[model samples]
Structures are given as structure tokens and as C-alpha cells.
Target chain A: MAGERSSMSEKLRVLVVDDEALVADFIADLVEEAGHEVIGIAATREKALEYLERSAIDLAILDIRLKGRLNGIDLAQATRAREIPHMFITGSGDPSTREAAEATGPLAILQKPFSQERLVSVLSQMAQRDHSLN
Target chain B: MRILFVDDDPDTRALAIRAVTHEFPNATIREAMDLTSLDEVLQERPPEILVTDFDLRWTDGIKIFDRVKAANPLCCTVMFTGTGNEELAVRALKHGFDDYVVKGSKQLRRLAITVRSAYERNNRLRELGESRDLVLKELYHRLHNNLQLVISLLRMTEKTLGHESDRQQIADLGRRIQALSALQEEFYRSEDFRRVNFSSFLERLARNLLETSGGRIELTAELNLVELPVDLAVPLGLIANEILNATLKHASPDDRPGHLSMRLEQIAETLILRISGDGAGSGEDPDTAKTGLGMRLIQRLATQIEGEVSLEHHAAGAAWQVSVPL
Candidate 1:
């Protein structure tokens, strides 16, 4: 499945945002392995904002809770303004939190400990959409 | 229970305390004639029951009620006043006073009875609230532990990865963990924290699974409302996940968009779940099918619920049916 997706879809420049270094690195590895470039990995909303300002990122995978005051939803507002597509990969199962995250209009809100295929599938779709748009 | 009597008149406070002590022989009674005494009593130990007079020189019964509630929100309050009117009684009750009694030689006994009744009712409510909090805390703790377990297992699996087969196993395990997490979310959403709407859970599970297919598999669901307890729902949900996962895996190799249909119905004493897909076995991957882990898991889950699972192959597609006694 990885080979098929890599061959058929255009590669995307992705930014991974999560507070936990292990989770952020794991997602970064998955994004890179799925034929996408990991432009930056940020553990806080401030760092994520810095990456967004400096890089032409095609996608951002965000974790809702961050190391700092601002959470991923706040960062998503900036991504929305810049017309950058993003998705949430969160550990929160709180309905109110999910509703708030959904209000930001993400591509998907994949729960924590989600399958690699699920994330790769979303990435593949983003790549295909990017390919078609260009 | 501890009782606080607040009134400016010393004789009125004494009369009220005497009646309450006679009714509750083992009760600890305290009196407060002004703000200083009230603060001293409240700070020393908040009362479980408060009886205050409305026409006090320093404060009204309403203000006294507010103070006692601020100290202990669960404190039961009774207004024992000589200046009570119908409107004042209404206002006191609306302000969350437990009972109102006009001061008379006969009303003292009524005040004791009202206080006793209100205290009992309050005790019941407090117990209910405590139980609900305990259930929520336990659910939260269990969910945290389960998530930690899944993360630990994943980390261990990653460290031991050698071949593509191991990677596939990890992905499958992740989906199963997600199925359990979805159940936990449903439990939280449930009003009673006891039963979950299985139909809604099924629809959500199907939609999420199909979402990963990227519109390759179209889903049609005809689900009947069925609420099941946690023990029954857990295995059923896992079984549904495995069957759906297997179907999607089989359907993926087909180039054309596939149609997957799911139906859930409760008939008499049994719940019937049927799932079918037109893309079944079109380009079957012998490697994934050879493992048979999904099928084995389904059978084991069915046994746990004392249910039955049946699979059928047809010219157009394949179908799976699971029936569990309701």
C-alpha cells in the first residue's frame, strides 16, 4: 500500500506538532515514510506558528494539548487563515473538546494510538488533492 | 448531624434548639445571635442543618441561608420566623431553603420534623452525587490505564519489528485499541454511565473505518436502536471491528468503488447484525487471509457474548451475520 501511494500521489511538505517528543517523532517518521517531507516538528503552539511562518507546508498534523498555554486548536486558527490544511491526532475523548476541534474544520480527527494506515490514508488523499489542484 | 440555630432573640434560639434536640437526641446543637458568633460557629465546624429566623436584627433568614450554603452547599436550611408571610415563604423556598416554619408554640415540632425530612432527603442526594463522581473517576482511571497499556504495547511492537508482517500486525492491533477507546467514549456520553446505544456506536465505527478507505467503499446502514450494557457491548463491538476490517481488507484490492451495507435489528430476544460488501474476494490477498486472526477473533468474541456468527459467499458479494441474545 505504501509503494502504491508513493508512486501515484504527489509528495506533500508536512509539519508535525505534538507535545511528546516520542509521538511527534513517530508521526514525523510516518509522514516521511509515506513519501512526504517533514518540514518541521514542533512541540508547542509557538514553535508550530514559527514553522508555519517560515515554511510552505502542505499539511499539519496537530495534537490538541501542547506544552504551552495555546493548544492546537489555537494554532489551527492561524493555519486556517493561511489556507493551510491540517488534521488533529489527539488523545482527548472529551466530546466538548472534539466539538471544538471539529469547529476548526480539520481533514480528520484521528484518535491517539490510531493505525498508521489511517494517517497514511489521510496523507495520501491530501497528496492526491494537491496533485489535482496543481 | 450538627444543627445551627441563628436568631437575634436569645429566647427564640433556645426554644428552637430545645425542640431540635428533643427530636434528634444525639444531635450536636449550636446557636449564633450575630455575625461574630455565626462566623465562629461556621469556621469551627459547618452544620449539616441550619434553622434561622427571618426577622433578626443583624441579618434575615435569606442572608443566613446564603452564608450556611456558602459554607456547606449540602447544608439543609429551615426558616423559623415570627415575621413570616406567604410571599416571604415563597421567596425563601425559591432561594433554596429546605423548609419554612412560622414561629408558634406548635410550629416548633413542625420545624423539627421538616428539618429531619430535609436532612434525610439531602443525605440521599449527596450519596447519589458521590456515587456518580466515583463512577466517573473510575472510568477516567481505567481509560488512562488502557491508553497507557496500548502505548506500551505499541512501543514494544515497534522495537521488535522485523518484517512487513509485523508492521501489518501493529496496524491491526491499533484498530482494535481504537474500537475499545470508542466504547469508552460512548460510556462517557451515556447518561446513566451503565448502558450505551449500540446502534449509534455501530454507525460511528462503520463511518470511521470507511473514512480510512478514502471514499473507495460506500457505506449504507440500516441500524435499529439497541442499548446494551458494557459487558455485552465490548465483545460485540470488537467482533464488528474485526469483520469490518476483514471486509475492507478484501475490498481494497478492487479498482472500482465498493458498496458496503450494514444492518442491525433487534427481534424478540435476539440482536441481528448483518454486513455485506460487493467487492468481497474480487482480488483477495492470500497473505492477509492466511493469518485468519480476524476470523478467529470474531469467533472468540461471539463465544464471549454467547452469540453466533455466520458467513456466506454469493455470486455478487459476501455477507456476515452475528446474532446475540438480547
Candidate 2:
């Protein structure tokens, strides 16, 4: 089964959004290695909205605690409006922020210091679920 | 040196960052609401000295200082905790804490001032970092104001040349210089002390220029971005003022519209500003070889930033392109 899953095609299209450039790049690298195509990376809410409007990415990985005036809660609201699927990756698991993320329906919240393997597995699952829904 | 505040309350952390920064403005102050964050802040920006509280959720202040000592024995340590007992403070000092303070409402103000004064005295010798910045900031403002006064005097004397255009030009340039100086004064007065966010700054600059424009042209801007420092924001604001004045003066009333638009941009490190309008259909570019007061002011402001200016006259209107490297 693992071998069959590895050989599967129709590469997953992913968008990684994080304010920190290094974290965004790391997510992109991990996603690509998991047989998915990383489309683009955005560091701001405006840029991410633009990407969502124009692109056909299968799923997005949003970091909760962003640098700008808008945080993950704001981005999730935007995604919900468009009915886009997303999972959150955060350096923090604070109760308030976790509650906010949970109110947006079923979301996979992964704590920071996460490994590349964990990222690939979670994103791969999200991409597959999105594909089946579409 | 590093001062750490470990408490579950956000107020305490903020109070600590403010109080410690006030005491040793140059020293790196890091706070942790808990030990984990304290450890993280420490790992990122290590302070020369360490301070902690005895009562923490995950770890005690004693363990925190011991970790600090283990990481670097040279780091000075101070422990202050409200819930902690004397045994903890004694243990912390014995291990590595250079000083200890008890948190109490009774002696709160006294304890704070004491901690602050002690921190200042301990770091007084090598703590000239912020003092240097303060002196340099003072020097910058003094130079700018002196230059403005000199320019104002020259302008006042020049207006008496008895030529309408010369007097108008002199007054215009005078206002532009004054605007620049005012912006400099305001910038140093800001909390950040070096940058001006452009949206509100430009709005005020436009209002000031319109007041000085004698009600000829209505000024408006469609600003989309913010966050430019004093070096660029002040000159950009002045350049916009001068450009608007020149366009209004040179254009025929029938030929040009009563309003001009100034749009600014900050694309990464490159800042671009465009001033465009129907120059009363005269086809004359105000930003040209024919020198005038506004032209001279724009030139000076542009050269100050080592930027370039170009004049473009299209069918719809004329526009000035100003680009600078930040």
C-alpha cells in the first residue's frame, strides 16, 4: 500500500504561507519531496489572498502567528469564505489561539519543532481529501 | 546584560520590559511568562545578565539561574518572585544569583526603584550604547533646525527682491524647506525615532502645502503603502509639495485642472513617487532644465537621497518620476 501510494500521480498542488522566509522555504521543500508541487509562497495576508484568487492550489499551509496586522484567524476567515481547505502550522499552541483555530471546523493543528516527515504526511492527507472532494 | 521576568501575568512582563529598559536602555531585556518562553528568548537573544522569578509553572527560578550558569557562568543573575520563599532566594543566590528581590505590594515601588538603580550602577561602565544613540539623535535634529533657520533667513531676505515670480518662488521654497525641517523634528520626536509611516505624514504635508498654495489647486493623494524612514519620507513629502506648487503656478488656469494627484509607492527597498496632472495643456514640464524655486528645491531633495527625477509628458497629462534607494 505504501508503495502504491508513493507511485500515485496527479501531483498535489500546495501553497505555503509564512512570514518567516526560512519556514516558508522549508515547507515548500518538504511538500515537493512528498511528490507534491509547491505552487508559490506568500508572506502577507494580501499576497496570500491574491494567490487564492488566481491559483488552483489543492491546499494551503498557513502559519497561525504571522508578522503583519492579520493573523491566521483572519486568513482562515478568508479561506472559509472561499470554501478553501487549510491546515495550520504554528510555533505556539496557546489555548486561545487553539480555540480560535478549532472554531473554524475540523482543522489539523500541528505544533512547532515539527519534522519534515510530519509536515509531508499532514499536507499529503489534506491534498488527497481536497482532491476527492473536488 | 539580560533581565528576565517570569510570571503568568502579561502586565508583569510588560512592566518588566519597560522598567528594565528604562533602567538600562542599552541592556537586552527579555521576558518569559513561563520558563519555556524564557528559555526560548534566551536562546534567541542572549542577555549578558539573567533575572528570573522563583515561582514558575514548568520550572523554578533556581533551575533557571542554574541553567543560565551552566550555559555561561559569566552571566550575572537576579531572582525576584512574589510566591517564592526565602529558602528559594537564598538557594538562587548561593548558586549564581548576584542579587535577589522580594515582590510585595508594600515595598513594590521601593523594590522597583532599587532594582532599576542597581541594574544601572552595575552596567554603567560599559552601557554607553544607548547614550551614544541619544547624543547622535540630538546632533541630527540640531543640525537640521539650524539649517532650516539659515534657509528661512535667506528666503525672507530674497522675497524683498521685488519680483513677483522671484518672491513667490522664494516663499514657496521657504515653505518646502520648513516642511522638511518640521518633518525631521517630528521624526526624532516619534517613539521609533527614525521612520515615518507615510499615509498620515503625507496627508498632513498635503494639507500644509494646500494651505500655502493660496487655494489655486486642490491637493489629493491615493497612498497605498506605509513604513518609510525619515531619510526618505521627509524629502519625499517636500518633493511632492514643491512639485505640486510648480505645476499649479506654471499651468494656465484654463489649460490645467484645479487639482493634482500625488501617488507614492514603497516597492521593497525602492521607493517611487509620481506627481502627475494636466499642466493647463501648455506642454511645459515643470521638472526641466529651466530652473525655478520649486525646481531647485526638488533637485536638492533628490540629490540628498542620491535619487533621480525624470519628466514625462504624455497626451493625458505630465508626470514626474522620482525614484530613490533606501
Best by TM-score: 1
| Candidate No. with top DockQ | 1
Tell me the native contact fraction for each prediction. Answer: 0.13, 0.00
Deviating ranges (above 4 Å) for candidate 1? A1-10, A68-70, A78-83, A103-105, A115-118, A128-134, B1-162, B280-291
Q: Write one digit per residue (lDDT tens) for candidate 1, span B1-326.
A: 78999988888888888888888989988889899999999999999999988888887888998888999998989898888799999999999998889999888888888888888988898899989876775566446434735664675576688988787877778788878877777786786667998988888788878867778889999998889999999999999998888788777455678888899999999999999888858222445443578877888889999999988777666788999998
- List the candidate 2 regions with Cα displacement exceeding 4 Å: A1-134, B1-77, B80-159, B214-216, B229-238, B251-257, B279-306
lDDT of 1 by residue, A13-86 (tens): 88899877777777887888888899899998889989988877888899887753339999888888888888
Query: What interface root-mean-square deviation (Å) does model 2 yield?
Result: 25.3
Q: Chain B TM-score of model 2, please?
A: 0.53
Model 2 achieves a DockQ score of 0.01
Q: Write the per-residue lDDT of candidate 2 for residues B147-236, one digit (tens) a residue.
A: 434553554466468888677666655566656654654564454767776666666556555543445666668887577777777777
Give the alpha-carbon lDDT of every model. Answer: 0.82, 0.64
Query: Interface RMSD, all models, one decimal each?
Result: 4.0, 25.3
